[model samples]
Target: METLKIIKIGGKIINDTVALQQFIEDLSKLKGLKILVHGGGNLASETSKQLGIKIEKVDGRRLTDQKTLDVVTMVYAGKLNKTIVAALQAKGCNSLGLTGADGNLIQSYKRPVTSIDYGFVGDIIQVNTSLIEILLKEEIVPVFCALTHDKQGQLLNTNADTIASELAVALASSFSVELYYCFEKKGVLSDMTNDNSVIETLDLEAYHTLFQQGKIADGMLPKLDNCFNALNNKVFKVCIGNPKMIVDSNSIYTTLQL
Candidate 1:
């Protein structure tokens, strides 16, 4: 089986033009099949505030009410996806921008209203591995935005990290998949305020300990959940770190092992 790399990038890299450009350039240098899954940083929220819409979140996952959902769709599937695709194109990579709606790439349903109502937020149920495989075989790099849809046509907000993880898991049987969760920090930090405090390798036991101690909370919580889920399902490697580390080996990063 060929090796496939599914990279998820979020944090400040989404809004930083220079950094995003450099990151895409570096990503293009990586050989073999690859997919890019990206998050909407403050773009949705900022756009919301401008339009007089309120943004809400529960556990760092946005509560995608109807109004907020529209904004996210525009920002995530529109401006952001195209920008990344254009950059990758300039670097000589044939990039295909995708919302989970396109080619029926991802199928999901709205998150259940349990203790709290998550509104239009989605819980992904399926990914079309065949479609992704076809694109890869054609040498097309997929650039995915954090937006998925119900096969019935309703668009839903999805988490990019989870998307990357699920995609890796779906492709694992056909390829040796490496799932990467990239962001602004060098890696998962022991001290949130210190950039140098990267935990080089994180295991399931350490992850549980951190969660119990309240060291990992909010957004990091689901991301770690996805990481462990991917590993347990047989992803070859899972990583969290600076985007540049996707190309540069000397760069510091965190590698997750089960």
Candidate 2:
């Protein structure tokens, strides 16, 4: 089977012009089929503020009300997605920007209200693997934004990490998929304040210990969950690290294994 790399980039990397340019160049050089998933939460938050939409969060997860949803949809599906696709194109990589609503690439439903009503938030239910496979076979790189839609015609704010993991899992039967979570940090840290305290390798046992000890929390909590999910579902490899680690063989980073 051919190898497929599904990399999800977020945090400060998305907003950094120089870093993103370098990332695109490196990605263009990667061999085999690849997919890029990106999150622009910081950009979305700033856009919401500019549009006078109050950003709400509970446990560091966005509360996507109607107005905030509109802002994110425009910022994520529109601006950031196209910017990355254009950059990839400039690097001679034929790339297509997409959202869940585009060609029904991803299907999800609104997150049901429980304690807090996260208005337009979505939990993904399915990924269009056939469409993704066709694109891969055609050598057309699909760049995905953090947006999903109900088959009923409503776009919902979806988490990019989940999107990457789900895509990796869904395609594992046909491809040797490797999922990557790249961000500002070097890797999963033992000390959040110290960037040098990177965990060399992380297995489920270590993850549970650190998690129980509260070493991982907030944004990283869900991210780690996505990592394990992909690995358990037969993704060839899962790594969390600096963006450079994806293309750098010697770079120090966290590797997740079952």
Q: Which residue segments of model 1 deviate by more than 4 Å? A: none
Provide the global lDDT of candidate 1 against the true structure. 0.90
Tens digit per residue, CA lDDT, model 1, 1-258: 899999998958989989988888888889999999999999889999999998787766678889999999999999899989998999999999999999999999988888999888788999998989999999999999999999898999988888999999999999999998988888887877788999899999998887788777466778888999999999999999999888988999999988
Alpha carbon deviation, residue 62, candidate 1 (Å):
1.9
Put down candidate 2 lDDT per residue, 74-179, tens digits, no spaces: 8998899998899899988999999988989899999999998989988999988898899999999999999999989899999999999999999999999989
Give the least accurate 10-residue stretch of model 2, judged by summed lDDT. 40-49
Runs in model 2 lying further than 4 Å from the true structure: none
